[model samples]
Target chain A: MSKVLVADFGTGNLHSVMTAIQVVSSGSEVEASRSARKIRMADRLILPGQGAIGTWMSELQDDNVRQAVNEAVRTKPVLGICLGLQALYEHSEEDGGVEGLKVLAGRVERFSDGLNDCGHRIKIPHMGWSKVHQTCQHPLWSGIPQDTRFYFVHSYFARSDRDSEVAAVADYGLEFTCAAARENLFAVQFHPEKSRRQGLRLLTNFLNWNGEV
Target chain B: MPLAKRIIPCLDVDEGRVVKGVKFVNIRDAGDPVEVARMYDRQGADELAFLDITASSSNRETILHIVEAVANQVFIPLTVGGGVRTVDNIRSLLNVGADKISINTSAVERPEFIEEAAGRFGSQCIVVAVDARRVPDTNPPAWEVYTHGGRKPRGLDAVEWAKRMCDVGAGEILLTSMDRDGTKIGFDLELTRAVSSAVPVPVIASGGVGELSHLADGIEFGWADAVLAASIFHFGEYTIAQAKEHMKGRGIEVCEIIDEFE
Candidate 1:
């Protein structure tokens, strides 16, 4: 059984993440904790966050979760979701620019005002499910087909500096990076927990994955 | 493509079971809230809203338990409403895995409550539910906001209240037409259009959804970002897949339904 630690940054839906992980990955022990030692000891780590970047940053610092996450990601597979994915970037334009964890070389950007293919004005939050186009092959993508829809709810999206790190892309008004992957880290701007069957498949893959590229 | 229009199935819960009725009368038991919610999730519902119609304090614990149970198995966006009078109530629901909280009566009583809740939690998590009814005697036949489950009408105009709620920080407006509710004729397109145009946030055109085409009309004509229904879905008149297929055929963008699990 895998020991998975869902790092609680005090912002997002920590319980839901833990619930999804436990429900999808049976036999694996999943716990949501703010403890640095527990996070370091886990086989896999999940950094789940939501809400504003400014408050998230402060909470991470106050709880010292930023350092714990940075340490855990180096030696183990780490996955970030929603604001957690954005937090892995260098900085974000949210709340007048807040510094992120800088685990990945990217910046979070807001969608510009534009009309979609339907000529309708795009909503800001980009709320609802959308298809994720796989840009490259990885263990996490196993058993999941290309262009599978995942649930997304955010105003800002991550733009990785290195195109090689982008694992998948999705279109709103324009195409943007939705999932990023590095040596031992994989982060998605969408919520896999809320993506139904495909989401559960991805979580199951994560549970079975080792810390590898 | 733009974000797909959402089709949400609302479950009016009382003391932990799912119930449905016409205009809050002639209520009938549907089933266990969690089981019904799981069925809808499997049927590919875009979202789910659970309103505790029995807002009495005695049933509050049961509602929270139901929310937790549904949230565990549903794996989709869940919005919980009824008796959300304070930030603490919103927090409790969110803690139990509710993605959003809808406020109706409290929002009308203290308009600033919308601003406060939206400010504390992000606006995306705050939904202002407006239950409105048409008043033909007015010069423009304005719709007035109703409280206590459409039993009491307030002086505030529906469109104006929707605009104010958006300005203050309501991420979405759940506009329900009391006149058209449960009648199965269709949504009040005029009222939906008025509010949709008045606010920049996404508007969920709710109530009076009987036929499948009404769902399409709510998007094509009413300019609603989403359409919500209870009776049709609860009674199994049409599956969510059928509704989405019909809407897609009508040129409305909807999330493709994937029924298989690998």
Candidate 2:
């Protein structure tokens, strides 16, 4: 029996995340919890947080999840979504420059103001569905085709100095890293839970990933 | 290509049931909220908005149940609005499964409510709804903001009001035009362009949409980030796929289905 724990550390809304997981989990055991022990015992870990990274990090520390998460990424398949993806980086420009979980070697920077795409001004938060281009091969990319449109809503995005870890690319004002892959860790800026069938397919891939690259 | 301009179908629920009309009157029954939601999801709608028009506070529980049921089955962003006044109200809806909270009446009553909710929940999920009607006999032409189901006018300029809402931390604006709502000639492009140009965040154009061309016009001319409609999509007059294809043909970027089963 596979155990999946969605990191519900009381920092962000995990209702949709939990529901989407159960739909794709079939008969697997899926629980959304903040309990540090349950988090460590789970076979797969999903760390999802939104809003500001400062509050997200503080709450993770308050709930004693920071250390547990760092340990989980080293051994199990870990998936991050939205701010959950941003928090895996080392630092961010949000909330006057906050620190992240440092699970990957990158930094999160806010999308510059007055960004124009094909002569039209692009809005901040980069809301709605856009195509996601696969940059490298990973188990998570298994059934889903390349450049599939996924739902995105954020003001900032992440970039890694280590190109090998970059798993996906998306263009708003310019192409940026939307998904990163490093061994057992895979994180995405888009919300797979809300991306409809393609999204549900990605989650199903995560449930059966086995932590392989 | 950048982010696809969204095609969001609005479901006005009264006591947990979905209803449609020409102008929020002569209500016609359209199946259960969950069933309608599922149908839209399967048809590849970019997003779904649930506006509770139920008159009394007693319907709050019913709305919550409807939201939870749809959220569980449909794997997409669910925006729930209608009578959202308190932070606790936002929390309760988000706790159930709402991705975004739209505020209309309460926001007009208290402008700071947008700031408070945005500060607590992040601007990404806070949407300010503006219902406006054109001010006749004006030099440059303008629209005035209305509240209480368009029964009262607040004397605020619609374009300026949208910018102010964004300034106060509103992530998106749902701009609805009362003058052209039931007539269905098309979206108020002049109003849409004015507000879309005034705000820094995304503006979702609502109210007037009769043909597929109106949906494309909202994106192409009105400069709306998303186009929302009712009756047309509810009555099965046009599918979201057909709408997206129409938009794509018009040189607008839209998300298309790529092996939904794959």
Candidate 3:
């Protein structure tokens, strides 16, 4: 059984993700911690976050979490969800534009105003579920069909420097990257824990994944 | 596909058990909240809302426990409503796994509470529940905010109130048409369209969903991003998958996942 450490950088929905990880992995030990020791010792790491980028960044930078997360990103298998995915980028348009974790090459941009789909005004935050299309093959995409809708609640999205890094994309008036992947690092802009069976399937895949692209 | 319109099954909890009060006059025992939530989740329910209508505030801890149980098992966004007054209440619900907190009476009483809650908890988690009743004898028909289950009027315009709620940091508005509520007819399309058009946030049309056609009308004609119903879903009149199927037949985008897990 894998020991999964969900890096809780003082964010919301921490328990939701923790419960999901445990439900998917029968014997896997899932924990929420800010301890660098537990993070480094865990077999897998899941980064879950929400709310503003300013606050999320500040909390992550405290208690040696920033340093610990960086180390885990380089060596251990790590997964990011929602705000966790945005933090991977170099910067974000949220909170009056704040700097991100810089783990990947990208910038987070807010949805442009007055976007219409067939004359219907698209709301901000892009709340609710949307279909995610797999653009590349990865272990995380296993068992999940292409265009499977996942629960997403966000205003800003990631714009990667390279298209090859995008594992999946979802549309909300405009197509945007929903999942990004690299060696030992995979992140999604949707809440898999809040997503149903397919979401649980994705978490199961991640638990069984060895972080090999 | 764009973001699929959400279909939420609202369950009213009273005294730690699930019950549905049709128009707040006839209360019927539905089932356990956790079990019902699981049934909906397996049936591809987009989301679930637990309205704690437990009159006695002493049993407040009951809904929290129920939400915690469901959140631990069910893998979908859960919204808890009915009697959310303070930031502490919002924090407690969110901490117990409520993806969103729906505010109705408190939001109408103190608009500043929405601002404070949204500021402290982020706008994405705050959902202001607006109960709108159409004023009688109006040329084009205007609606006003009514609290206490449409028994009292807050003297505020429904459309303008929705706009104000969004302006004060509410991420979404759960607009219920008091005039159409419990009527088998349909949603107040005029009221829904007016409010949805006025606000930049997503609006959930609620309070009068009788059949599958009403669900479609709420999304297609009313311009609501989501449709919430209780009676049709709680009493076994319709399942979520069936509702999605009916909505999809009408060209509305709805989400359904095929489980590939062994």
Candidate 4:
């Protein structure tokens, strides 16, 4: 049995998230831990978090999950949701300043005033159900159809110019990165678990993906 | 660019359990909130809204237990409503991981609720749910907005009420046709277009939806941001994948579906 580690320290939807994976892969072992550890025992790792970056960082520190996550990401499929994805970046300006896992070469920041200048036509926090624009080719989108609408709930978005890492995007007040991935690490700004069946297919695809380029 | 139509599955929960069917009379076992949520999570449901149906009058606990349980298991965004009358309720739901909260009866009975909730939670977190029934097209004709699950009529024009809600900071509107709900004869497209055009906030066309094509009509022709239905999904008439496929073929942009099963 391929063990899938779902790292949870009282953040976002950890159980429903595990249920999503379980639905696709029959049943995989779900371990909710504040301190990430023992990746050798699992085939993949899921990093799920919901809430502000500052709070998540504090929680991680309180439980010492940072180093354990870094060690596991070295040779595992790690997926992050909402703040979980943000935590993997270099840093965030959510509250004062908080440094992230920085496993990837990028930075997460808040959306700034674009050409419109009035800020985003959409309200701040960019919450709601919006559609995503597929910007790149990645196996995570395998069975997924084009121009699909995914559930999104967030105010700040990640800013990455790596080009190669961005997998999908959505336009609210402006076009922003919705999905990003690198090697064994994959992250989406949108919540796939909350997105229903299409999202489930994405999870199923991820579990069996094999990271085909 | 035309906004893509959304196929949403709504779960009406009573005391943490999901109930379904027309006029809400023939309620059947729709599965545990978390268990059913897992299935929809896999089905690629565009969005899921859980309505407590009686959370208000009963003054029962806001049913955050299911929210906690379901949010823990599902990855997609979750919007919760039903008896959500105050900003604290919205705060509690969001703190518990709900992406958004829907407000109904409260908004009509007291328009201030819309402004207050939107001001405190940000317009994005507030959704105004309206139940409208067509009451013959007179000089102005008229559509009455029903509150308390169609038990009481607010005696307000549906279009006017929608405009008022938007003006007061409603980020989105969940509009349902009382006559068409559960019948699945098709969506009240006429009503959908009116509400969508009247407000800037995204409008979710609810009440009646029979087929995937109906979903297309709701978004394309009806101009709704999302389409909500229960019977089809509850009875297994069409899966979210099939509905999305139908929409995609019609040149609609749907979220990607990673098909690993086939």
Candidate 5:
């Protein structure tokens, strides 16, 4: 049976990630764990984070999950969501410039304060559903159509240095990299746990993947 | 396209079952909350709200179980409210997979709870629900805040309460018009506009969404960031797609649904 470990860094909602994994892949054993030993033993790792960047970084340090996460990403499949995706970058401007894990060569930047395409002033959190355009073929996007709407709630987004690592792009004020993949690591800015059927499909794909590029 | 206006389906739960009633009386069992939530998720609902109308101490565990069950099946944002008086209560709900927690009576009892909860958890996870009624025969014809499921009048002005909630760090306001609720008219446009413009945060217009056009009115005229409905979606009157289509026709930018099943 596939064993999936959802690494809990003590910030944001991790329950939804565990529940979604359980529902989508019933045969797999899913555990929302903070223990480094449990994380290392799992076949797949899900790094889920939320809230302020500096606070999440401090909690990750306090829990000593950084080494465990790095080892897991090198040896097995790793998926990041929301702040999890943000943490994979080099740094973030949130909370006065907090440093990230630097797993991916990119920086997280906040959306510019302005109006949207329709000339209506949008909220900062960008809380709602939006379309995600698949930029390339990836196993995670299997069975899900291009430009499917996914639920997003965040003020900052990722900017990758290498364009090829961008698996999907979404438009808010402008097109931004919403999903990134490098070797065994895949991450998304949207909450797949809250994206409905399409989200479930993505989780199912992740469960079936074999840690390939 | 702009950020799509959200369409939320609210489920009023009593002892683990979805129930609906007029003014919180003569309640009728609708269905299981999990099944209803799963159906709405499949129907392309943007989010789901579960309100424990019976917020009795004995039923607290039951609501949590319902939330857990729904969270397992529904892959969407779930907001749980009622009987959430303390930070521990919010923690318990979030631990069970709730994305947001709505506070009404408790917030009205202690306005500082809004700041405390928002401070502990980010404001994005805290929702302030305000149930208001339009008071006629007054010089300005203002709205009064009601607590205890709209049974008690707190005498707080609705617009001012919304502003205070925002100032205290409420991410969004779920403004429900008691007079328009269950009356099948529409949202209180004036109240919605007043609160939406008063705060920098988003406003979710609730109550009295009778038809598809009413949903559009909530965004176009009421200036709501999201429109919430119950009876119409709970029954077979209309679907979320129909509402989105109507809103799109009215020049509102709605999230496009790419039906993969078809």
Candidate 6:
């Protein structure tokens, strides 16, 4: 009967994600709040964002949302999407290096070069649907197939300090990590709300995940 | 990375309600803006832009009330524009919970409005909306800019106006092709590309979308940051979920679509 809290940072596809959650996890309540102060009471949390890494982190610093996120992740199932995923890192290359929340032990860096050693031909912001190669065991993939397509629109991606944090990898010019999970924390570069069936399945899985063996 | 395709659903509101039309005329009444917004919210729409087509002429209070209702009900970022002529109007829209405020007629009539709004609200909050119609010239055909819901023509060239809007303050540009507006034949790829490449800020392509493939083609060939459509979505011709699925099948990167019925 407890409701799930979706963090609304005044930016991103918060509503789309919340609606998906509501449908996938029917009968459960969903609430959205811009203030991080309201996030602590939720049974779980969804962080959805749309903006540059630098600007999003800047606003978080201005609002002191970092601490609220850190505390929530400690005892709750937290999912980060797009800019929300980038916010989990220690820093980002956006705007010549802005510090992230450091909830995950890594940094968000821009793609260095291109696939096949080709010149910097690919666009910097990786926007669109890409195939995700699952690597870790997370209940969020209950009915989903391996290497299913998910939506993504981001320039920078997460680089975990530990190898185990990566939950899935997506292919672009070369294979890269698209989704990551460390403990109760989970994040994806692609957006689930914008992603169709696979995205809904993922949301359904997240809702059904009981955090128990 | 190829430019990501954006699936944008635009709401045309009259008297604080949603209405649709062809070529920006012969308006047809749709459902409540807030209710429609909630529907799109569930269907995995990438973004929502609320065009206050009648707010400039009357019922400013009703417009804000509609915006507040939709914003409170939906979770995605909302961009509100129509009859916005001053920085005060821009600020008020943002204050009323708009993620961004779009300006068209004002920016063309008084170019300084863009700069002043940008100065006060930052480029992120200010968006310049341009309506362009292809007109024949003695030498080569060109798209002439129109204002006040395509009723008046601005002497300035659209390409030049785009650059000027960026120079003044617009953080983004919403370019709608009047020729394409209800046709759904496809987007004006030339117009979208011209304006997107000209402005440094993000460009959202509006008008002339008949199918899902058109959205893909516009983003890929037109270089649009986002693609906006009205009739296709308003009349249930296409669902956001289906559009996203088809876009994904076409190898375009789109947001994960949450199915409405699922």
lDDT, candidate 6, B1-262, per-residue tens: 4334567788888887677742221233345777788778777786688888786546777878777676555545678888887666755665555767888877877888778776654565677888999887534557889988887998778888888877776777789999888887999998888787666566888888988889888877887768888888877878888888887887766756433334
Residue B5 CA displacement from its true place in model 5, Å: 1.7
In the range A28-122, model 4's lDDT, one tens digit per residue, is 66665564545446678887766556766776684446666776676777788888778877888877778988866677777653322322133
lDDT of 3 by residue, B134-214 (tens): 899987889999987678999999988898899999999999998898896999999999998889898999988889999
The fraction of reference interface contacts (C-alpha pairs within 8 A across chains A and B) present in each candidate is 0.55, 0.73, 0.77, 0.19, 0.60, 0.08
* TM-score (second chain) of model 2: 0.95
How do the residues B183-225 of candidate 1 rate in per-residue lDDT, one tens digit apiece? 9999999899888777767799998998999999999888889
Give the worst 10-residue stretch by lDDT in candidate 3 chain B.
Answer: B21-30
A21, model 5: CA deviation in Å?
0.7
Two-way DockQ contest, 3 vs 6, winner: 3
Of candidates 6 and 1, the better by lDDT: 1
Instruction: Assess candidate 6 and give its lDDT.
Output: 0.73
lDDT of each: 0.86, 0.87, 0.87, 0.73, 0.85, 0.73
B1-262 in candidate 4: lDDT tens per residue?
3234566788888866777742221234355777777677677775678888768544345468788787766766678888887777877787666777898888987899889876655566688999999987565446789988887988899989998888898878899999888787888888888877666667888887888888888877777777787877777777778888888887776765555432
Sorted into a CAPRI-style docking class, model 4 comes out as incorrect
Model 1 per-residue lDDT at A100? 88
lDDT of 1 at B189: 94
Tell me each candidate's TM-score: 0.94, 0.96, 0.96, 0.65, 0.91, 0.69
Prediction 5 TM-score vs. true: 0.91
lDDT of 5 at B105: 94
Which should have the higher DockQ, number 2 or number 5?
Answer: 2
Model 3 spans > 4 angstroms off: B21-29, B259-262
After superposing candidate 2 on the true structure, give the runs of residues whose Cα lies further than 4 Å from its correct spot.
B21-29, B260-262
Q: After superposition, how far is residue A122 of candidate 2 from its true place, in Å?
A: 1.1
Identify the candidate with maximal DockQ. Answer: 2
lDDT of 6 by residue, A40-90 (tens): 777888888765566566656745566777887777888888888888888
